[model samples]
Target chain A: MEVHSSTAGAAAPPLSPGDFRELFDSVDAFLFDCDGVIWKGDKLIDGVSQTLDFLRSKGKKLVFVTNNSTKSRKEFAKKFGSLGISVSEDEIFSSSFAAAMYLKVNDFPLDKKVYVIGGEGIIDELQLAGYTGLGGPEDGKKTAEWKSNCLFEHDKSVGAVVVGLDPFINYYKLQYGTLCIRENPGCLFIATNQDAVGHMTDLQEWPGAGCMVAAICGSTQKEPIVVGKPSTFMMEFLLKKFQIDCPRMCMVGDRLDSDILFGQNAGCKTLLVLSGVTTLSALQDPANDIQPDYYTNKVSDFLDLLGA
Target chain B: MEVHSSTAGAAAPPLSPGDFRELFDSVDAFLFDCDGVIWKGDKLIDGVSQTLDFLRSKGKKLVFVTNNSTKSRKEFAKKFGSLGISVSEDEIFSSSFAAAMYLKVNDFPLDKKVYVIGGEGIIDELQLAGYTGLGGPEDGKKTAEWKSNCLFEHDKSVGAVVVGLDPFINYYKLQYGTLCIRENPGCLFIATNQDAVGHMTDLQEWPGAGCMVAAICGSTQKEPIVVGKPSTFMMEFLLKKFQIDCPRMCMVGDRLDSDILFGQNAGCKTLLVLSGVTTLSALQDPANDIQPDYYTNKVSDFLDLLGA
Candidate 1:
């Protein structure tokens, strides 16, 4: 399956009524990034549920792909239901799940334990994939002394260190992760996504997973194998699981780097939405490298463009 | 004043009796890095006290320079005394002091307070320099919830966010520093040094100031004004305060990048000591770009070479 559109990463046109019909027919599935597309923090975007219902009513496949490793698929499903959206847990492909899938695809030894510098989402996904994860919320309260006579211990069985959005980032986890990656033979360093900041709250942006990953990167002097969007790993997982061809899919997201870039990497058509982190000027600027095939105001704009 | 040494960063010759005599006569003052050179984590290097006495007997100016931002100059002086070395607090130049001096040299507004993501050393030094330091130990116990409804407030008076080694590092401090650096107008992002590992304990190496600084760098999407060794800021402060010229000083240290490069950057003759983090093979490796004028097993070798 290959990209069917000629306007790949070019100055995109706004989705017209005719273009919406063309997109509706050309793509058999739509992969939407959840944070900015489906909702913003805990609040649902306007007309999001109705638009999702419209796509589902037309027999189009919808996958909610998100880089937020904070919550599990079950939690996301719960969030969707709470926001009055009808979505199953199986429709989500979070970065935490992607990380677990990455390990599974790599044939990671089941006997070796994986150390995590993330949240419970990563822990749940790893356990669901038959891997034991250590150092998540359990290590949240753990700290290394500034200057002490005591020595810290690291598990010898730690085969990998997976980093994500860890609010519990502390000195002990940093030291432990560093020791594991540096000292453990063949220890893999994996990162969910290097997002600079997150729409953590309704009012403000907070430090994202990149800060945590960068800390470990500095200490270990090693770059991690990024297993999230823009890497094509998630695309591969989605491809195998859903058995959907890239040519039949359209990717919708607010972030140009992770979403549009991931779509481009996966040989799928991409639509950039301005409802989240991006602005009109940012997309129009020639300095911006990543461009989508089509752009609109929001995910709900598809319905408005078609005069629903 | 220019360095008169013929072999600069070349295949450095070992410090022999003849070479020691030449170096002793040529340089008026000696600058020693504390951690790996003078001692290794609370224990004084062998004959280090004797070497200092010998240098004092020969009328050589002695100064202790350390990139550790964890302790104040007074604390370092006490550590030196406890280890059987009588060094004045004023003779010590720590990175924490350099950070405070950097603000003074840069003419930072006196009324603007500085936010710290480090230890009491930075706080003490900033206080000593008449700058109010917030968010060091005060924010150490503070934490941001994984998902919270409360909004975090950043001090509008914060004109700089200085980062160092903080064992008590958490998300709240990271967020606060990020806000201060990103939200405040003309807010300075200062880092003591980007040292990768700290010799925190006698048994093993721990994550360094670079980890903490890198975290802030990731969040703010900004580079810091490094104030420690290899930056020449500390060198400039030392020169102006001690009334010593770089050409008349011999810099002896362990690490190649911070210590040796610092000496070379300042146009001072350098002596590499293998008693710390660097190995002789590491120094001999032609792939290594940084080289000192002379190499020795340790700081005490100066006395051994001269048969003191």
Candidate 2:
């Protein structure tokens, strides 16, 4: 519970991982959160390219883990390239991708229709993974129509629950989602991510796909196996992709709760950047106790510490 | 788990000393939620007053238990009187009043300023209970400026954490609110209720007073002693005020979760009316599984049952 505040030029590694160690020290792979850390709404964060190059020089692997299931891996790759960062579809792990992998690996009948409650990203990902997407009832006043037609009537024909971001997600949809899961307990309850929301501009603000997932989760009292950040699913995917163990890894991010806590929980050293949801004043406040192993002002500050 | 949908009619008993006899055949003092059961948006339901008088003539006691902490018992009496119903202030059990009573009786000390994060209702109630209503930091931009003047200062003069229906509540207020309670664990954490939000024009609105309570409760991981409807606080208030015991009571309401569940938990027979949050459709939906001992189309039907 001791507050760690250091403003020295470079200090000894007194507390395990010190302030001035290489930002990517002893790390074989790196996991980054896409929206806030790498780019915030249409604009890329400064030094992301140079930092990637520096990590590439050190032979470190990079994987972008995003809870934004509304976009597929291909879509992410294209978006990343558009932002001047070179990335492959294989180098990304989205909750949708994880959900697809979960379904594929389990050998669940892929030809069946999935009652989706998300956008084009989820639809593309699931289809690419070899599953049919389900549409809601025609009348659509209540999801009860979908319940009778898509779910209950066909037992094993319903492949999985591919819940993603849909703004029109309402209580009736929530009711049907629960009803489907409750009806077929063996039917997979897969969520792309459990993130309640992502902050966009005020006018276009929308509840992330996770809010719908959570509402159903709340009703059923069931914890879905989350695939996105902070969940070990993405970390495992990244580790397997890079062929690295937990010790030889470091997690860098701006948010403390999900990003830093993810690193801490996964036994990796964490770097907290004060460029996003968390700030320096928040950490210094006596009330909050979420402290990271190392503190850097932004992702760009990694260069000063690493001397790359 | 059998669904009970019997309303006041041919099969139901006329208003007797125990309205619960037709259902549970046991129970005493009746607890009623005022917001939705007796009225909706300030409009009294049919047969509400006549039903109350009939029950009174049968020697059954009743208390108005409400989660709305803004108004005092006197205020409630006036509101009820305007609606052509005679309500004594002493017969009303308000969570705000209960919280104030708890603070006063425990000698928790009104020596410090109580930071308020609710509507004028809760603030006025706190004032009536002999506590100073303190506001948060008048300034925002500078954290240092915030530390000195904000109600969450790490000082001894702060009395407790009081929260209620605050439409203006945001991240900044929550951040400071979290700080205040964390800094002083002994500082009383009093909430108006735990409903995330209540009804508005459309959409599942924030359950007023209850939402902030839930937020703080989630953050601190400490459940506050709820004083509103469905709590023993209201039950005890009724017993003390009306000089009655539990065995001879019943409860009438529209929503099963709040009103009926309150009665069920409080050991009284519950009547569910289909005029508010929980409709007959919701109850019949299998997923909900909420069934009151008796069901009525509107609040007025209870008068017919009472033979008023």
Candidate 3:
């Protein structure tokens, strides 16, 4: 199978047939960023199914690596299934899973609870990691009025405050998370992904996990330990779990800052696709320093480039 | 009248009786930060009334200035009356008032509406400034789930999005404000103040206007035009309206960053009071670059230092 492949940074050289085949021959695994690479919103990118089939048929390990913490890997896999794609939960490496893996890898205290300020997927991942989660959608309806006189109550046993992309984010969660971080001794502040905005739907860009994280950061006057893309936490987790050589894995996505940067930090080959939020002009703009090892109009170019 | 007065940054000289009288006598008007300088939570600082009376008796003008946009001038004046202090709406300069004044001073289009993600006070002030405000507590109860497919409707006539100290801040307002700033052409993003935390009550420090501002800032990926303290917009408005001389006016508050820096930026004398958020150690902390012209234990010290 021929593929888009080049080395180093910006304006990677055009790949000849031999270069393409040679790069694919060395790659043993492919890491896909779901949103723009596999699909945009609810619709799958054309020929992506065929590309996945070709990669799997060639015995390449495939994993969906997404910064969206809005859904757990189980739910994310279901989304793929609904899109007429075959995928398993184990092959999904969402930021929610990364957050859970982070806690697990760091040997978080099992007895202490986690205070969440995000979607239910984070709670699901936390539960799977053997920790009870508090303050997800349950706190969405709760609110604090201006000039609230009394101190609000919070669980004393909270060991961490994990923030992610929460559509139901409100002031209650902001204040609660701040309390957990500031008042609760040694309470950890963690973020799944700090994406400023996300195409939760293609109709528009909405506030993402970064807004929630920024609110908490403004209150507590501290930065969280981000466990999502570009942090290399997920890369290390993938390395330890999948036993794949970093140099042999190719990370494909549309975002330069999140996906390509994550791949670069992971020591994996990076591919940028233009089917999502980033435009071709933005990629070619001189101000943008982030460069992918390879780039194409879309991930489906893999199949088209092969003349399959 | 006796007072705390010195020159330059860092520690200024301790005040002598002659120095105190000379300083106070030179001041024709005093601008006070309400929450911390005038009162702590519900209770007014001891001798604040006597100090106000003493200032008024000496024919010195007094204006209450606060970064809090949670209440309009009318409501704020009522708060003063409740505390047994005689204050009028015209004698108050709140961030809400400043926000309204900013739009008016800038000659914003009268036909265009405003989208708000803040307290009712901002809405009230906007109405007073002849602009209709939408999406405040009205949108607080609105909910948006993860992956909401439809784009929420927004008024195309919205000319600006004003954010302030919103206790009812939610994702709906965040998204709405984001849409206005991003989609509405030339729509201004205005923030009343960006104080990181506030003593919403003396018992606890809750997230302040900065959190709400930060949330929108994250979503819109834009920095707002701050019209509150340390920005000089309010200072310019106060000067234009009240006809006060800059050098003769003393800005008194318990916080260094907001009140003191505001005074400095406005080219007026600044007084730091230890009765509120700041302490002596924090004042002495070399890491802090903000230095007031003078400092004292509390505003009440104005009367005590008189040796009455």
- Number of the predicted model whose TM-score against the real structure is largest: 1
As for lDDT, the candidate ahead, 2 or 3, is 3
Error of 2 at B177 (Å): 2.4
When sorted by TM-score, best at the front, the candidate numbers are: 1, 3, 2
Who wins the DockQ comparison?
Answer: 1
- Name every residue pair that clashes in candidate 3: none
Best by lDDT: 1
Residue-level lDDT of model 1, residues B131-177, one tens digit each, is 99999999989977535466788899999999998889999999999
lDDT of each: 0.87, 0.61, 0.83
Please give, as one word, the docking class of candidate 3: medium
**How close to the true structure is residue A286 of candidate 2, measured as C-alpha lDDT?**
62
Tens-digit lDDT string for candidate 3 (B1-308) = 12223444547444556656877888889999987788766768788999999889889899988999978999998988998999999889999988888899899999999898888888999999998888876887887654545767789999999999888887788888988898899999999998888777756677888898888887777999999987888766678778977889989988887888888777788888888878788888877777787788888788767764
Q: Chain A TM-score per candidate?
A: 0.95, 0.78, 0.93
The TM-score measured for candidate 3 stands at 0.92
For model 1, residues A1-308, the per-residue Cα lDDT tens digits are 34334664478888888888888899989999987777777877899999999999989999988999987788888888999988888788899998998899899999999999999999999999999999998999986764456668899999999999899899999999999998899999999998777767656778989899999988887999998887788877687778988978899998888888888878888899988777889898988867788899999888887777
- Candidate 1: segments with Cα more than 4 A from true spot: A1-14, A146-149, A284-286, B1-13, B146-149, B284-287
Q: Model 1 chain A, poorest ten-residue lDDT window?
A: A1-10
